[model samples]
Target: MKQLNILLTAVALLLFTQEQAHSQIKLSDIFKKVTDRQSSSATSAGAPTTSEIGLGIKEALQLGVSAGADRLSVKDGFLGNLAVKILMPPEAQKVEKTLRGIGLNSLCDNVITSLNRAAEDAAKEAKPIFISAIKQMTLTDATNILLGKTDAATEYFKRVTSAQLTEKFSPIVTTSLNKVNATKYYSDLTTQYNRLPLVKPVNTNLTAYVTQKAIDGLFIEVAKEELKIRGNINARSSTLLQKVFGYADKKKS
Candidate 1:
């Protein structure tokens, strides 16, 4: 299945490359014809030669990081946003359902809600870390990314910032969870659930679980914002941003 998926992706990529090359050829030919006609008529009467407007690796990625982090730091950012809401994973969901089925629904619900709240609160601190990464980008970074595949910019940001962001965000998530009483809530729930009839009780780690979930949610939101800024003309907030992101926009369309 994985190999088949890879094959399909390669085919799609080839088609996209053909289309892009076709467009570039068509546009270049048109421009050359126009330039020749203008030169024959009058050199000064022609439109000025247009420079390439594509963003290099450094600029596109820096813009992506900035735009993504900006969106996350705003009011209702990750907390109130449904698209980035942190929810229980499959394993944890099973545990919750099992506890609920055995008459421990209240505890399960408390733990679930509190875990999400902690993640939402923790999401606020993501901007600084992302900004720091963006600041470190250089012209070489831009060139390398321009030659890479789709989502290359995002992948680079993940490699550089994921660990640092996790470290910075973990403590905040932990504090938020504790502040919301998620630890005690899960503890009491587990106690009651464990006491249930004929069940093998298992201890769960709430802090570690919430920490992972929170970070996952943060990255998901950041990626969405990055994709938008890279693809959508209306999302560019500055002159440099528009120029930089225009490259990605053209690459997509």
Candidate 2:
């Protein structure tokens, strides 16, 4: 019995030593294991860092333009929509106000409506040129634009394509103005407005003004679409957009 008790005591002592060793594992050692695991995971994941912000910005800008352009190309997208109606600039505004102030409101209304209609007609011709611009947009260009301000992409577009678009749009607007009888309406309106006593003689090139206004309106619409995608969760139409923009959304949150 004494021998058996001694053997039992030895076995119990061995188990207690093992249990104590297991429980006595150093907190610092445990913490080191966790740190090593985290470091290995971080190295393996290889997520894009701060340097790639330019790239992300570019992707977002391109996506915005794509979405905006797509929306603008549709029927009633630019033409029938009053919200984005193409109108005159500061120069033409003076002419319009004078005309309306002189009780020639009907003539003034007609001329303004005709100008916008010409723009609407001319805008249809812009698809090919705008598409070419989009196609020519390089990864670097997109990255730079993405890194730019809210209107940076727009400014880039204006800098790069404005001359070409203006050149192309002028003839189209002129042709559309003629097609829609804009020249005659504006001529009559101008003659009536200029004859008003105490008013300066007003001479406006309807074609040039309409063309520029139309292009500006198109850009405005494009920007709206871009803003929607950047802000509204539901506006993200594709998986690529969702995946890429998901990061942007997280940052905002």
Candidate 3:
């Protein structure tokens, strides 16, 4: 009977030990899982997702395009700003100089004014094209822009939209030039210059020249807007902009 009691006690002790070991394993597993979940959450909290980055980039571009278009579409936006003012083409510089020397300054002034006016009119139509390009940006493109140089976004826009902008701006510029009498004035100026003794015939494509200049001016404005958003915290108007650009700032630092 004593031997039977000893055997039973040993069995009970063994079972208790096994139960404690099993409980310890389960507790360890639970703790590990909890720790892992907390770590994952913390990591996610610090970094912006790919989707967030893309959205932020698009928003910034939209703001840039809108601001640029609005500013340039206004009166004297190109003419008043010497930085982007449309000047006579290189080949026609002598014509302007000769005309001015002959006291035809008023005619030269009119041509300059009309050229700027046509650019302003075309600038108003650029917002839609820029917005469309912004919408079409892929995740990879957005990621690259976010991490690229200060004017990387502007470069991307130039690459993607230049051809389309030219195609669209050609007709608009042509019509605007005709509407503003730029074509007529330039034709008259060139005709007069050609009639001059020993002067080469100078027939510049006013439409092409003005269209390219207008596009260049628009890009300059866009670059400024992009720089503002990338560098200035206040320019980040939305929460997403703040979050994504904040991440970018940290990464750059």
Q: What is the C-alpha lDDT of each candidate?
A: 0.66, 0.69, 0.94
Alpha carbon lDDT at 103, candidate 1? 80
Stretches of candidate 1 off by over 4 Å are 1-82, 102-104, 248-253
Evaluated at residue 218, the lDDT of candidate 1 is 62
Give the better candidate number (1 or 2) by TM-score: 2
Best candidate, lDDT-wise?
3
Cα lDDT of model 3 by residue, 190-222, tens digit = 888899999999988888999999999999999
lDDT of 1 by residue, 1-253 (tens): 9999999999999999999999999999999999998888764433211222223333445566556555555554555667765555454566677877878777877777777777666667776776677667655665455445556666777788778877877788789889989888877866765776787675766667766766666667556755675567787766656654554455546
lDDT of 1 at 58: 38
TM-score of each: 0.66, 0.67, 0.81
Residues 1-253 of candidate 2: C-alpha lDDT, one tens digit per residue: 9999999999999999998887677766888899999999957745344445444544555566665555554554555677676555566678777767868787766766677777766666666666667667776666555444556667777777788879988998888788777888888877776786888777877777887887887788667766676678787666555644565555446
Clashes of 2: 2
Q: For all candidates, what are the clash counts? A: 2, 2, 0
Q: Candidate 3 — what's its lDDT?
A: 0.94
RMSD of each: 19.9, 6.8, 10.9
- Superior candidate under lDDT, 1 versus 3: 3
Winner of 1 and 2 under lDDT: 2
- Select the stronger candidate by TM-score from 1 and 3: 3
